[model samples]
Target: MNCKFLAIAVAVILFCRPGHAQTGATVLDDFKPSSLNQPGQEYPQVNSQGYVRFRIEAPKAQSVVVSLGLGGTRGGTPLTKGTDSIWTGTTAGPMEEGFHYYHVTIDGGVFNDPGALNFYG
Candidate 1:
């Protein structure tokens, strides 16, 4: 029981740390604070009200899904093509304003969010 409690406590402390700690850098620096939002933009590059957003610099895909976890959200949002093969969308949140892990999925597959820091949760 004591061992279990100790392990639990350690896990809690690590989980409480800002989601970007996995990268060994600050989330603010990771996200480029200055690029949080552009003048007259619909959403922020980083947002509290919405989830993290990203775009890939790849040619148009037959399909794409941005998985929230290192693996993928059991059921995550699928990416819709934006102009120039850019994909965009938000996640089901309850997420605090900070960095989180994610990956891109092309054609019903999952990939790590190469641009963002990743955590196992």
Candidate 2:
């Protein structure tokens, strides 16, 4: 009888403990963007005329394209090599003020910039 009481007590103690005591609740973040292209930044490389310029860093990519809405798809001009694993492109003209999308086309794959903070429809 004493052994039965002890076994029941042990079972109650084990089941009564809070679940968080073993594993706490967690907040999960799904780090997936809706698009492979990135949105334009609020600020770009400004020229003397104060036209904001945009820069896309894709040194590994043989071909990078920036599609500016209404402005058209601008190819990666003056691609320069860098120390890191990347290929870069710059535009001669300042990016027109508006919504834009860009992707680094590498080996026929498009990727979004994790650092960029913009998105397009």
Candidate 3:
């Protein structure tokens, strides 16, 4: 009886271990407007984990994508068009802390985010 109890305890400990018990990734809902955003703009937000989210309004646009993702090598983060004609998307993974430059591509036309402040170097 003692051996059976010990085996059960060991199994429970292993099953309850951190990282092993989680069934899926957790993305925090707490996000705020980016510091670089233009006044009154709510999009181009960043989360605590460095995940950036964008919301653009282009009612007739065919496709919208942000030029920021996976160290800027994996094309970019593609935004999905919602029923309201808004394009929104979040980065696949957390980005490195600090400033990063990006642009928006709408229907094959590249353009800067109108909501964000422009940065020139």
Candidate 4:
């Protein structure tokens, strides 16, 4: 029993050590508009690393959030409003490759992204 307890304690310590988490690789700046975007839209871009970036123009909105992150387990990716009155944000991490359904929340009301082509289901 003592041996088992000692092993468990060591494992916990190793896992909790600082800098033992994800790598510190920087997110590249190379991003392009998603192919699913509307014909002249420029936002909702995807980077090579599979990170998704969103930009929404809602000058009067109090808050804006994107419903695309961690498979929707987390509420969503909250955007920060810039001085230009445009809200923007990036996913916390790289997302799995493939099509993903997402929507925007402006001032608490959910709405589809005007820049992105609508996809049912």
- Tens digits of lDDT, candidate 1, 51-75: 4555554565787666653224445
lDDT of each: 0.53, 0.44, 0.86, 0.86
| Per-residue lDDT of candidate 3, residues 1-121 (tens digit) | 9999999999998656664322255768899999989999998999987788999999999989999875245589999999999999988777767788989999999999998999999
Candidate 2 TM-score over all chains jointly: 0.38
By descending TM-score, how would the candidates be arranged?
4, 3, 1, 2
Distance from true position, residue 105, model 1, in Å? 1.4
The ten-residue window of minimal lDDT in model 3 covers 16-25
RMSD, each candidate, Å?
9.6, 21.5, 12.0, 7.5
Q: What are the per-residue Cα lDDT tens digits for candidate 4 across 43-76?
A: 9999998888999999999989898974256589
- The parts of candidate 2 lying over 4 Å away from their true place are 1-65, 68-78
Residue pairs in candidate 3 whose N, alpha carbon or C atoms collide under 3 angstroms: none
Residue 59 lDDT in model 1? 63
True-vs-predicted CA distance for residue 4, candidate 3, Å: 61
- What's the lDDT of the predicted structure labeled candidate 1? 0.53
What TM-score would candidate 4 get against the native?
A: 0.77
